[model samples]
Target chain A: MSETPDTLVEPALARTPLDALHRELGARLVPFAGYDMPVQYPTGILKEHLHTRSQAGLFDVSHMGQLRLCGRAADAAAAAAALETLVPGDLLGLAPGRMRYTLLLNDGGGILDDLMVTNAGDHLFVVVNAACKHADLAHLQERLGDRVAIEVLADRALLALQGPAAAAVLARFVPAAAAMPFMSYAEARLRGIPVLLTRSGYTGEDGYEISVADDRAETVARLLLAEPEVAPIGLGARDSLRLEAGLCLYGHDIDRTTTPVEAGLSWTLGRRRRSEGGFPGFATIRDHLDHGPTRRRVGLRPDGRAPAREGTGIVDGGGRPLGHVTSGGFGPTVGGPIAMGYVASAGATPDTPVTLVVRGKPLPARVVTLPFVRQNYYRG
Target chain B: MSLIKFTKDHEWIRVEGEVGTVGITNHAQHALGDIVFVELPEIGREVVQGGEAAVVESVKAASEVYAPVDGEVIAVNQALIEEPARVNTDPQGDGWFFRLTIADPAQLEALMDETAYQSHLEDLA
Candidate 1:
């Protein structure tokens, strides 16, 4: 965080393989998760956001951690079962080439992190958030080291080509990408550059997340950008897009203090896992599933243009405290302010009236269903 | 003749007699990105020089627009309520926030003129 004064000596920030490319494109770099990443480009955030919705947008998400886990003697079934011990997902039943979103919980049922686990036929591929990657790596090693051998893919870069036009654009380079089903993964060549492709994205759009070699990252990105339908997007638009998609940002919408059920992520808990109760915090999670949580995460739509920012207080019509906003901002797609926050479960019903205290003033708001905009995943 | 003066905080005031029109400078708007919301002070509210006067929100964050000089607000731009993008399109002309009765003309001397304000922006860059 840049909260420290400029006069004080700041720690050196890590740079991605595309650092020079970002600067060359006139990106305004800022400190994020210990990396100097681009927040916005010359096109600005508002335009970048709208562009990603209507057309294709290329994003550099290389700072996230990517790792591979293989069972001893290269047994993938054993690896999947070993991973099931740490997460609430039914990885053992997960089909090859399919990815499942899961959470890492502490013994107390509090969420430590959320990650995506993909069954790569012979091994398991996982992607974790940048800020929590180091801790996640340590936890995985400590708990499942004996059962699985973890290998960090530090030399790879992740890129996301997202939007309704993403499939068509990617088809020009790799024809198979256009036919891949949602949440499916494959390894293919993009115009001779070997890459891993996941027909999934954070923006709720039908797109692909590509993993390429660090040395070939810029080349692959440039190739994608050269397409007339694609534009370079930055972190600023990435945040708005995910928020509009009703996605949770780690360390914000969820943390060690909140549980998967409380975060409205109970769906990530597989049916078998729920009944078997083997993962960490299974008792508390099962309890929450049996009895509703005291507080629940819900979508909030402020009545006017003014956005209710993070940490803003949520109150009832009578000014009684309920909870505080975790992620809030203007949704360019919605053309108004949108927010997500925790509130008393009793008042979490859709269309329920609520008030947001922004800058000491009460702003009228209402609880609504999430994904303010419709999700356009490529189900076929 | 009207004269324009700027505060170090990027607010600009153009005086034409006792009433001065105030708004954030173009430089400020550029730094803030696209403007989405504007909160102006109530008419007839008295404000001190360098005190919080208005709020301008961009897609990313909100920023306070400080009063360049002590004054009493007389009129506010209602058009901003319907279309805040004016602050980005014409920050110097139609995007003015409010008009205030100058409480002390002497305060103008402390503000930076165009030449000084341009140099100030350069110093920041």
Candidate 2:
């Protein structure tokens, strides 16, 4: 769960294994989640965004926390069930090689973090947001210490190759990976390197997220970059791309005070869990689900050219304060200024006119059904 | 009767007689990334030296464009409204932000020339 950064107070900036490669590509490195990450490359954010939509872009997401959960008795189901207590996902029924997106909710139904859980047969592979990884790992340890062993996968680096032509480029290296459908994963050996390749990504594109050993990260990255369709994308385009997909950035959109239901993520909650109710904050979530949330996340498009930034107020016709924007920027694909914010549920419907108070000036904006653009995930 | 000067804030002023053309330096535009929108000053507005004159937004963030010297707003590049990315591709030539009528010629003395600005950039590194 990455947050839209307004400013930076760089502490001890940690470097990823691909740091040299990023510098070599003339990436503008900035402090993000305690890591010196590439905000953009020489190609610039707009071009990178367009490229990803039409072609492919490679993103180094090694800052994301990768972990493994092993049962004390070699029981994958037992481990998954134990994890179910922390998240609303029905992990106990999840088949191997399939993944489910879940939220780690606090007791009051607030999101602690959103993460992906993949049932890898023997153990569970989980990826959490970079800023929330430490706290998430500690939470897992305190909860499942007796039943399962939580091992942080610090030796692996994560890479995402995303866009329309991603499958063709990736297939050149690992032909088997081309057959993998969306949300499914398999362990594959490519170019003499073993990798865990998942057919999933954040950019609303058909792609794969590859987990490779730290030592061989550059080797795999070079092999992928050698493809004609793939280019190195920075966090700037990544933010814009995810925003166009109506995906929420962790701190900005959904925080400890925001519930998954309010964040428009009730779909992540499993049906069995919705009925049986056994996860953290289950009662509060159930109550919110039964009684519609007072406010909900909605997509906003300003009528003018000015980009409404994070924290811009959402107001009514009379300039009455309604809510605030959580994530706002120029979506290159949308060809206009786009934003996501929480407004009173009354004005959350599509085409509902509202004024976005930006820089003390109220500008015309309207609620739109999310995504703003079409998502092209591969089914086969 | 023309001269070029720079500000520590990364603005450039190209003086031609009583009128001065102003824009962000190429270095400044590069640092800002892709420019998405530009809010220009009105034609009759007066801008004080080092005061905010306009706003330039990029995919990353919004930055206030400060006037390098005191001047009266004369003209703005209307084409920039449709193609703000011009600030990145042609920051020096076609990307010139606004034309202003000089309020006081004395303000130019405090600014840096090309040599001094080049050294200033090196000093920042």
Candidate 3:
């Protein structure tokens, strides 16, 4: 079925620091998360996605929210403990220069947002989805404002240099970046320009997310693009890459209605927090942990070449309703159609047969292990 | 003599006698990005003018290929089932979707000719 175009009148979209640069590179600009962002460049999403997996792809992710969470006394430990009340991760165990992925949950065990929290020595560095940033800020303020100061880093631009060759390409600018272990953070100077570098990315590749001042974002992007191994990637490829990696996209694969356990993100719930039950919806989350969720998100591999898209319904052999696809598209790396959606726990087994209803036709598919493509993180 | 016509929807129909070879214009393919899949109309099925005759899926989304005029599907391009990218590479030539027996030649008058279609594209831009 053809997707309906958004015809609602839009307010003036905000521009990223590299907006002009994206246009100069022949990007097809589109409104995304209230920002005028590049959907794809002249290279197109297919080529851009494959390029990121093989070489390095530079992404302009400045639209996401970045904030500093510090205790009243500027103590990282105190701030981490205060933040722990909001998320299910073990932020107190997050050592200096280390980062952990966690989810902000509502009182009923629903996920508010999934975010990254890094122990930045003096304070906690947090990054949340662009669409949920404002709400997350308000949530943090209303809950922990008195104990922790939430400072929005509005003047910063975030860039991700990701792929198999990302380390080598970044090393030319900051030699030490290549040696940083996965999930490690550092305040480093790239060619004398100070920036925050994190050895992490959304593409499941060895990479770095660099946070730089807005004014220098374009310069830094241009410098990285000058490298033979680096090319500018857009939101189109980013979505496909993350989808193939089995990572969730906010509001699509996950949202306020889904719990971490049902989303197959039980690992994000810290071991200590699992038993202590201090986070919001801890009672419900603990129940889900003790007894598996009624429905669990599983990867779907559609038979044949036709791609099953989001909102496509899934059914069993007898045509009983199972669930609907949350994220589905062509996985260029997997060389076939891949999808992720929730299904009854009885039908969530890998290799179980399921039918995807596409345009009123029952298309054969199977529940498969997530991450159509294997993750290649650099642990060393 | 053979005549080619274009629709405002970016579909093109090349008419020869009672049969018309149909496909999407290059502009439409470029706008849709990479073509990942194509679903052609079933042979011998009747279609109405401006009705959805086929489906072309890009990496990003799926779009309907509307019929330029009334016709009866005669044959489909089976090659696209395995090589949909051909639509992106040669949208108007080898990427022809299907051949149909024209139901009413008068319906073709509403379609834009090459010159008119070029101007129509410019207006859209």
Candidate 4:
């Protein structure tokens, strides 16, 4: 677990794969998920955000957990099917090189963590959120350890090249990466280094997340940054970008107490899994889906300028307590403040008048459709 | 020229006789990533020394700008409402938070001058 830095005695923070490169590039490093991460570069958060939208921004996301589940080539189906017992996503139909965004669930239908599951040719590749990695690995170990091989790739570093021009920048290095569609992954070579390149990202943009050996991380990152269209992005703009895209940040939007249904992630539940009902929390998730969830995660667009931050009380027009703001911030692309939080289902409708109690004052806000900024994923 | 003074909290006051213009120091703005919103105090509002007078919201977090000395708010920066980014660009000038009628001009003696404030920042590091 990462220690919170106090004003006095500072705690030791781990460095990411590209820590030295980040310092050379003028990044303002901050502690995140037990690692010293660049929150923003000298280019600034706003510029990095705008640059990613217009061009491409490369992000070092090595702190996340990368794992592989392996068995015999033909028997890989068994490993994939076994994973279904924990997550509710459809894994049986996952073709080679395909990827799906799914959640790890507890027995009570609460989301343990959200992750990406890919069907590697002979095995399965999984990437989980950093903070929940230890727990997720332990959960899998206690559940399916005897059935399959769970390999932790601690020597791997993950990099996300995101934006409208991300493909163009990456194609210059690996032409094959240009052919992979969204939500697909393949073991490919970039600049002569073997890496797992995936056509997916959290920014709601057409992007590629490259997973390379930790030792070669700097070389890959520098090559990408060398592209005219690519700039080194930091965690600051990453949060803002994902916020505007209506993506959830673990430990904030969704936790062990929040079910996937309540978190607006029911779409990730596979149709077969919903009926087969063998996974953890299957009963509670199905029941909630059958009879609409009592509460829901919805987007909020404040009518005024003041940003209603996390933990701010969300109230109705009459000042009655409705819910609370889970994640809120000013979105540069949306050109206004955007937030997402759980509200009573009745108040979750878009355009519902609500008030965010910011600093004891009732700040006017309204429910808006999620993805405050529209997604630009490459479909073809 | 108005004599400029700074507080330990990183606020600056440009004292021009009985009136003073207040704003956050450049060092403070740099610390607060990007300034996205500014909540100004109401004109004619009474303020106590070192009390909350304004609010500045950055992309990272929100911070309260305090009154360096007891005073009555004579004017608040209206331009900040639409362009709060100005605080990041020119915090000590166009980003000035407010102007107030000094309730106790003698309190100005407690603030640090440019040289003293510069040395204080070094001590902090």
The TM-score leader among the candidates is 3
Worst 10 residues of 4 chain B by lDDT: B26-35
Please, what are the lDDT tens digits per residue for candidate 1 over residues A123-147?
A: 9999999999999999999999988
Worst 10 residues of 1 chain A by lDDT: A1-10
Report the candidate with higher lDDT, 2 versus 4: 2
Give fnat for candidates 1, 2 and onward, in order.
0.34, 0.49, 0.46, 0.32
Name the 10 consecutive residues with the lowest summed lDDT in model 4 chain A. A1-10
The C-alpha stretches of model 2 lying farther than 4 A from their native spots are A1-9
Per-candidate interface DockQ score:
0.43, 0.48, 0.56, 0.42
Estimate TM-scores for all models.
0.97, 0.97, 0.98, 0.97
| Docking outcome class, model 4 | acceptable
What TM-score against the true chain A does chain A of each candidate get? 0.97, 0.97, 0.98, 0.97
TM-score of 2: 0.97
Off by over 4 Å in 1: A1-10
The residue-by-residue lDDT of candidate 1 on B19-84, one tens digit each, is 999999998887778889999999999999988999998888888888989999999999999999
Which runs of model 4 end up more than 4 angstroms from their true locations? A1-10, A72-75
On the 0 to 100 scale, the lDDT of residue A259 in model 3 is 93
**Alpha carbon lDDT of each predicted model:** 0.92, 0.91, 0.93, 0.90
Task: Give the Å shift of residue A324 in candidate 3.
Answer: 0.2
